[model samples]
Target chain A: MSNEETAGSKPSEKVIELRLPSRLGYERVAMDAASSLARRMGFEGDRIAALKTAVSEAVTNAIEHGNQHNETMKVVVLLTVRDDELIVSVTDQGSKSIDEAYVSRVPNISEAMQKDDKGGWGIWLIRELMDEVEFTKAPGGGNQVRMVIHLER
Target chain B: MTTTRQHIIEISFPSEFGYEVIAREAIATFARCVGFDRDRIDDLKTAVSEACINAIEHGNKKVHGLTIDIVGVYDGNMLQIDIADQGIQQYQVAGAPATIEEKIAGKAPARGMGLLLMTQLADEAHFLPDTNGTRGNRFRLIWRERVETLEPEH
Candidate 1:
């Protein structure tokens, strides 16, 4: 079972895609799917947990910010497993420009806590847990946040 | 596609995790009507979920009988969503750990990520406190359709 053939367009890669309604209930579905994929990629313990958290945050962001809790909207999650890396991309139909969504620096924790601020931490966790994070405008005007976890690390 | 008239939808529901689906689905439908593609729609879904969940879990703390109000507006190529929760507790913002070692310490709670996801997923995300005591915590998310030049008709 460990040596099962990889699936997808490329022989060495496997891809799993899901289109879910923009609902918090569906977040669990994405998280579970991501956890299973991470496990299949031989991730253990903390790495698997990290992957799950990252995926949850990403999907949650999509359903919340991208779709604005609009039921008619759909959140698409794509998981690609390659020999060296696991890449997950969560795309939403939001019109936010990529330049606007990108955060250049990690927020300072003490300052944020001092103000009693009540939000602004999901992207940082995604950056910390994943090896590489990219935000781009998806085809047809929405945004896509792509996170990659290197298997060897 | 562009429209001269603006469309607005408003809904209020209890601050429970279950009701978050209603908000997400409504926003998504509006986004689709505004002509957002699959990828953009997904982004809207995640961002809205983060905002709504934060309001339910943290802002209202799942307090019984509390409500979260959602307003979605679509104008031309722009979509705006506002989620407001009754102010029960002060919002707690999560800051980044100073050191990578501290970040890896595994002691930090996962609550802080909601705000970060909001800013990253939406074009503009803002948190407004109800200083006047009328509204609660108001989280606003805005996305604008990029104007693409069409190829000249041959």
Candidate 2:
């Protein structure tokens, strides 16, 4: 969202916030919310699908790793709809801090296939699907991932 | 976020028109995961949309900075939704709603249709007490599961 917009220039920016318990199936709420907003903004079918996938991976990561399956912890998903882009930020109330080195490393397919658990592709998938992605610590002490997808007019 | 088996979700959005669709979509997906059939999900969406509209138009008076809060919980046999709004104008605890013929004959305005729809679509829809240390008007909607589903208990 921009800091300044002339009055009566465009649709007012909106924000939808969803706070879900740190559970697996609850992530669908975030995904569906984002998909609805993106579709309303005229995002294409493929982009909406991509947005849902990216949102699912992000929320699933928040539940599985960030919150470590502790149902007491909550995963907060903020969807900000601007005139030109949709910004989604997923924050988890986790005690674990995110490692910077691990965030940027690209996983090799061969290496991942050799391991029993072929996971760890979430961050990479989000990075690939979203137009812009950033990971930072929440101001209130949690891990947050903010992803932005541009609306092609 | 309690330790009990109930699955609860809390959502809040700016008090504006058109955002209710997003809330409807979110809850529809939740209802599906909680084992509601297609017809029931559609009814839930309509009920949620009407309630959110009432929250925005009446409870918050369409104030831009104000927000509407929705909390949804699904226990084993019941799905309950609580839609709360900042009490700009207290909801009138009045008598029964107007009849359809009264509105058709221009005897009553069509303003009460939203509430009527809410009560009809949801199994139970009623307003919570506006007092007792609470700052807003809270409306609650409950839908009970008629037949047990195979979905695992939360």
Candidate 2 residues B1-154, lDDT tens each? 2355788898988778888889999999889888899999999999999999999999989877677899999987999999999889887556656778998999988768988888889999989886666668899999998965798889
- CAPRI docking class of candidate 2: acceptable
TM-score of chain A for each candidate?
0.87, 0.92
Model 1 gets an lDDT of: 0.72
TM-score of 1: 0.47
Residues forming the 10-long window of minimal summed lDDT in candidate 1 chain A? A1-10
TM-score of chain B of 1: 0.80
C-alpha RMSD of each candidate structure in angstroms: 21.5, 4.8
Reference-based lDDT, residue A99, model 1: 48
lDDT of 1 at B119: 79
Best by lDDT: 2
Worst 10 residues of 2 chain A by lDDT: A1-10
Model 1 Cα lDDT, one tens digit per residue, B7-63: 565655456665565457656765775678888889899999888888988788877
